[model samples]
Target: MAIDILSHRDPKVATDILKIQQESYAVEAELINFSDIPPFRDSVQSIVENDETFIGYMIEEKIVGVLAYKEEQEEIDIYRMMVDPAYFRRGIGESLLKHLFATMPNKPVVVQTGKGNEPAVNLYLKYGFEPVDEVEVEPDVWIVMMKKAQ
Candidate 1:
């Protein structure tokens, strides 16, 4: 897989990222028993306007995974990380994360994932992200916030 920076002005790239985001976040929603997760509510236009930088993982010229983040002061807040379910277990997510770490070696990274999404939470833990907090976004739906310091 190869990683490429995405252009927000490119409608096609934004559309592709939105598609991946919806597909991936749907699983998280189910795992956490919440259907109103932010990613599921995002539109292509909103994605284009987000101001976060997006990096896409391409396999055979097709985008199969994407990672989005924004740098704030000393921290990088990861807004989204998604891999096509078909591409799960293929290391695409890891590559995207490694790209982020390599590109911004000194910045602390922060992310939130559904507390019940073991795969995602485990992946973050494996990458050295320590669980720092949990927030209940809805009645019983909790998101686990994690961070990795530089």
Candidate 2:
């Protein structure tokens, strides 16, 4: 697998990331019983305009995973970290996270995932992230915010 920074100006890359995001986040939506997830509502234009840096994972020249984030002076907030559902359990998500940690060592990183998404929660925990808060975005739908200090 090849990992590289994705350019917002590249429509094809953005489109591919959108597709993967939809597929991956759909699983989370189902797990959490929430249909109003942001990824499902995102458009290519919004993704480009979000000003987040995207890192894409490719296999055989096709993008299968993506990690996007916004960097601040004191911390980095992970906007999205997803792997194609078809490629789950293959370590794509882990690789993307490891890459992020390696590139931004010792900086605080934060991420949010559906509260009921055990797989995601476990993955974050595996990487030493601690749950800091829970946010209710809709009725009975909660988001778990986790933080990892390097």
Where model 2 places Cα greater than 4 Å from the true spot, the runs are: none
lDDT of each: 0.90, 0.90
Residue-level lDDT of model 2, residues 36-64, one tens digit each, is 88788888887777789999898998999
lDDT of 1 by residue, 83-147 (tens): 99889999998999999999975988999999999999999999999999999888888899999
Q: Estimate each model's TM-score.
A: 0.96, 0.96
Q: In model 1, which regions exceed 4 Å deviation?
A: none
lDDT of 1: 0.90
